[model samples]
Target: MVAFLDEGGMVDFTIEYELTPDEVGRALHRGLKLQLRAVRLAVPTILAVSGITCLLVDAIGLGVGMLAGAVLFPFVLAWSARRLAKRQLTYLCVPTTLRFTDDGYEYRTDQSATTMRWPLFGRVVSTPEFWLLFVGKQCSAFLPRRAFTSEQQAELDGFFAARQKAGAL
Candidate 1:
């Protein structure tokens, strides 16, 4: 057994689980969707409109390129983001255990262990399936939601909400 306590003397959430390639892929896909939502929408809109403008002006070469970019950029980006999951998940050669508390989080695997403070993370974003911890604009860690029981999920939600309210996150 292990005890994880905050300064307020509350025990936090503990999670242990292995991530399948598919889950990793889905999480990565969702993370990218979150990060790129505006870009994805705006880029294609601009490209398509520009493509139409160029075509109307009889700039065939530029129009084709713009049209192609409009059609291909988002698809290629989405595909690359999905493929990135397979490569990134290879580091988890074994299941991992994670403990969350007000101070920070501790991560442990068969070969490695580390702890990081919550402030080191710029934001925490939860998808339907996972929690993504972002450092800068990149996602540095993902915790599978399935690892948490309903009570633990509530604990985690409260933890982050409190942190956000405190302006610590």
Candidate 2:
């Protein structure tokens, strides 16, 4: 198990696991849903308008096309997101470990390791299952809530709160 010592002399928790494809896919999909709210709404709205226009103009072909697109678009989006997530996770196939501390965080993989200071994250987003740390508009790292014990989770929550209050994230 990996660990880190904070400035307060407390040992921070470590999480070690191989991230599954499903987890990555779900996270990606969730992020897309949150970030692309307008797109999500526009797709359906446009499809509905197309269908209504076709009906008003008595064009069966246009109506069928809109219907087909409405039915197929979501499946296409999900499939594409899953494929991209799978490709991204292939590079992270090795067992990965993350150590969280008050000052920063460190991640280790079979191939390499890196440490990042807290200020490097421009934003911190908390989802139901994971905490996504963003650098600019891209998510830099994700921490699964299940990886930590209750006490460790509390420590992490406090750490995030302090960072937010300090305008570090």
Tens digits of per-residue lDDT, candidate 1, 22-113, equal: 88888888878877788889998999999999999999999999999999988899889977877887666369888877788898988789
How well does each candidate superpose onto the true structure, as a TM-score?
0.86, 0.78
Alpha-carbon RMSD of each model: 2.4, 2.8
Over the stretch 55-157, how does candidate 2's per-residue lDDT look in tens digits?
7899988887897887777788778878878888875656988877767888899888999998888877787687888787776677777777766767677
The TM-score measured for candidate 1 stands at: 0.86
Candidate 1: stretches off by over 4 Å: 1-8
Best by TM-score: 1
TM-score of 2: 0.78
- Say which candidate scores most in lDDT: 1
